[model samples]
Target: MSIKIYGDPGSGSLRRITSAAAVMGVEIERVNIDLFKGESHTPEYLELNPHGLSPVMVDGDFVLYESSAINLYLAEKAGSDLAGTTTRERYEILQWMFWSGEQWRVFATLTFDEVLAKRFMGKPADESIVNLAAAKLRAGASVLDAHLAKHDYIVGDRLTLVDFDIAGPFSQNERTKIPLNEFPNLVAWQQRLLETVPAWADTKREVDVRIDTALEAAGIKL
Candidate 1:
């Protein structure tokens, strides 16, 4: 049976899982859970994920929540080196994944929320909020840039689950205004992935379209 993924195409975390599936050539059926319509909070949907988050995965009777874990599981099942072939590699991969979510992504989302998300809702961005978020994002980017200067990918020299986990948010860099101009290595790394990974490029293309459609529906011209 094909794995089923429950999430909106506009969701960054959902995109991460789908991009990994694309890279590994895994077939998946995407089920839309409209956050705006409160579909995720419905009783039936909540049963799959108590937190009511997007991008839950169901492969037969097994259900998985959290994007990073789901991607790891998919990689392992697909026998892709994206999961890491050795224990040390696996731990290091997990380290970057955790850091991606806990340290880096939080600020990225904050900036996106204060800027793009608010703009979509016909709201003005608060300068204080946007500035704070951008500052944090820059600090995180600096660390990532320094690391990336020495390594091609987040965990190691090759593309892995950690790359997908960390780079997913950067797909919104144009819309969210992520400050990466000064980080040449990080910018170059992102460009390399987009150019080399057909799956990621395709997934990001679909995401861009969805974002545009959403913006049009909201009568917001970009």
Candidate 2:
């Protein structure tokens, strides 16, 4: 049986898992969960993921939550090298995934939610919150930029699950008002991935279209 994923199409976490599955040649059945309508808080979704987060994966009797973990699971299931070929490589990819979730996602989410996501929810951006989060995001971007300067991909020369995991948020940089121009290496790395990685490029295109439509419906101009 094909894996089934429950999430809204516009969800960044959802996009991560879908992008990974795409590159790994894993087919998934996407089940929409309208988070804006509080669908995720329902008992059924909560049963699958107590945290009520998007991108819950179910494969037969097995169930999994957390987008990063789902992506890793899909990679292994598909026998894809993205999970890493060697022990050290797998751990290194894991390290980056952990960092992306713990460190990068924190600031990125805050900035995006405040600057753009709030508007979609019929709320105004919190200037104070946006300022604080933007500052932190810039600092985090600096660290990533430095790393990208030494290597093309997050882990090594080749793309890995961690790259898809981390790049999901960056795809929304423009909407979130992230200053990619300040970090040349980071910008170049993102461009390289978009141009070279068909899975990510395709997923990002679809995601952008969905978000843009939502923004338009929300009466948000940009």
lDDT of 1 at 217: 83
Deviating ranges (above 4 Å) for candidate 2:
none
lDDT of 2 by residue, 86-123 (tens): 99999999998888888777777787778776876778
- Residue pairs whose backbone atoms clash in candidate 1: none
The residue-by-residue lDDT of candidate 1 on 1-222, one tens digit each, is 989999987778888998898888888999987765678889999999999878899999999999998988888888988899889999999888888888888778787777777886678878897788788878888999999989998876999888888887776777877786678999899889999988788888888888878778888764
Worst 10 residues of 2 by lDDT: 172-181
* Superposed model 1: Cα runs more than 4 Å off: none
Q: Estimate the TM-score for candidate 2.
A: 0.93
Top-lDDT structure, candidate number: 1
Worst 10 residues of 1 by lDDT: 213-222
Question: Using Cα atoms with residue i matched to residue i, what is each candidate's TM-score against the true structure?
Answer: 0.92, 0.93
